[model samples]
Target: MKIYVVGIGAGSADGMTFEARNVLEKADVIVGYTVYAELVKKLFPEKEYFVSAMKQEAERCRKAVEMAADGRNVAVVCSGDAGVYGMASLVYEIAASYENVEVSVVAGVSAMLSGGALVGAPLGHDFAVISLSDLLTPWEKIEKRLECASAADFAICLYNPSSKKRHDYLMRACDIMLKHKNADTVCAVAKNIGRDGEEYAIMSLAELRNYSADMFTTVFIGNSMTKNIGGKMVTPRGYKNV
Candidate 1:
């Protein structure tokens, strides 16, 4: 039995990769978080689905693996690239016990890519993608990463910027980065990326520290050379020739 871990990408057909779409289409069952389940149900309403709540990743993967072993073609769906903070790794870990099951991963555009496009090319040079949520990682570890990425001059992309309970996580991260980065360093926030109500704003690192954000927002802090070129948040690649 084989199972596909598919990245749905921004919860839209336009954002999903062709291979991801094909895998989902050919699968007999689709499994994912509740939000992702709803997103794909619109594209493939005829298929059966199994949805789990947030923080239920282990149980979710177990359910998907079980279905695949039952002679069902199962597709475990996730938003953005399956390998990037998605369920692909968990699936592999859980599927190791079942020698009969095969796992395949289908990649798609991650929020870093989709959201970066919305605000121009904030990732034109080296960059780092870090999640502000300490759900699985400790806050101290997250702080060290932010400080190091900033000191290394990598444009930084942030995920899970904020939630009701962790409202100040993004701001705290900014404070850490600011210790290495400039207060005037360029930054941007892209919300609802590749979906309705899509919007983005370019601002200074100082301004972003006070900016309101949510779980749906993807934050981008530029390297020292980043600039606001005609309303675009671009990090120059230093071509010299332009």
Candidate 2:
């Protein structure tokens, strides 16, 4: 029995990788978060689905593993690359306790990459990805990471920027970044990437501090070397000087 932990990409079938689609097609069961499951449901409605609400990650993975151990091929889906804050690790951890269950991870485009393309190439140079959700990680640790990334002038990609309960979290992060970056630093936000009503905006760090975002938004803050090129956010890789 084998389980495929697949990355469905940024909430659209067009964004899914060929390998990921094939895995899902061959799997006997599909398990994922409620929102992710819904997205895949439209693509592969014939497959059996096991959907769970948020914060039930452990239960979801356990169910996938149990089904796989019963000699059924299973696919556990996650938005974005499975290795990045997805179900791949959890599935592996749980599958370790079960015998005869193989695990295969299929990668896909993450929000940072998809969002970056929509707003130009702000991540051409070295960058950092940070999640603003403090559910599993402490706020202090996130603050330190933001500070370090800012001081190093790394282009930053933020995920899970805000939700109803944490509306001010993105603003707080912007404030921390302001201390290390200039007020005019180029920033961008991509909403509903690769899906309907997709929209993006480029602005300054000062303007971004007051910007509103939701769980579906991805934020990008450029480094000191970033600039606006033809109204697009861009960070040079310095290949021109070579």
Candidate 3:
């Protein structure tokens, strides 16, 4: 049996890659976390769904792998690319014990790419993607990554910037970046990318320090080379000088 770990980009039918859509369509069962399952249900209602709540990732992957070993085509869905903070790796880890199941990953667009375009092209050059969520990782590591990314002058994309429990996480992140980045450095936020009521906020690092952000927002911090082109956040790759 083939088990496909799929990334349904941006939680929108329009945002899904053709390969991702095709795999979902071919699967007999779809398994995912509740929130991600809801997104897939809208696009493929006919398929049988097996959903679990958050923080039950291990059990969820085990169940999906067990089902696949029973000779059924199963697809496990994630919000963005399956490998990027997604269930792709976990699925493989669980599937290891079950030799009968074959696993394949179907990639999808991640928020960094989608959000990067929404606020122009902050990702035009090299960049680092970091998640501020301390659920699995410690905050100290997050701080170290921010400092390194900032000092290296790499355009940075941050995920899970803030939430009810992390109301000031974004602000703290900005403060760390500010140690190496300038106050005037351009920064932007892409809120609810590719979904309804989507919006963006572009500002300097100083303004971003006090900005209100949430889990739905993807934050961007530009390097020294990044600037505003018109009203959009942009980081040039030196094409004009060539």
**Every candidate's lDDT:** 0.93, 0.94, 0.91
Q: How many clashes in candidate 1?
A: 0
**Tens digits of per-residue lDDT for model 3 on 1-242?**
88999999886689899999889889999999998899889888888999999889989999999999998899999987899999999999999889788889999899998888899999888899999999999999999999999999999999999989999999999999999999999999999888888999899999999999988899999988898989899998854643
Q: Which ten residues in a row have the lowest lDDT in candidate 2?
A: 233-242
Q: What is the lDDT of residue 88 in candidate 3?
A: 91
Error of 1 at 12 (Å): 2.0
TM-score of 1: 0.98
RMSD of 2: 1.2
Deviating ranges (above 4 Å) for candidate 2: 239-242
User: On residues 72-170, what C-alpha lDDT tens digit does candidate 2 reach at each position?
Assistant: 999999998998989899999999999899999999899999899999999999999999999999999999999999999999999999999999999
Highest TM-score against the true fold, candidate:
1
Evaluated against the true structure, the overall lDDT of model 3 is 0.91
Off by over 4 Å in 1: 239-241
How many backbone clashes does every candidate have?
Answer: 0, 0, 0
lDDT pick, better of 1 and 2? 2
Candidate 2: residue pairs that collide: none
Poorly placed runs, candidate 3 (over 4 Å): 239-242
Residues 1-242 of candidate 1: C-alpha lDDT, one tens digit per residue: 99999988986689998898899889999999998999999999999999989999999999899989889999999999999999999999999999889999999889999999999999999899999989899988999999899889899999999999999888899899899999999999999987889999999999999998999999999999999998889998874637
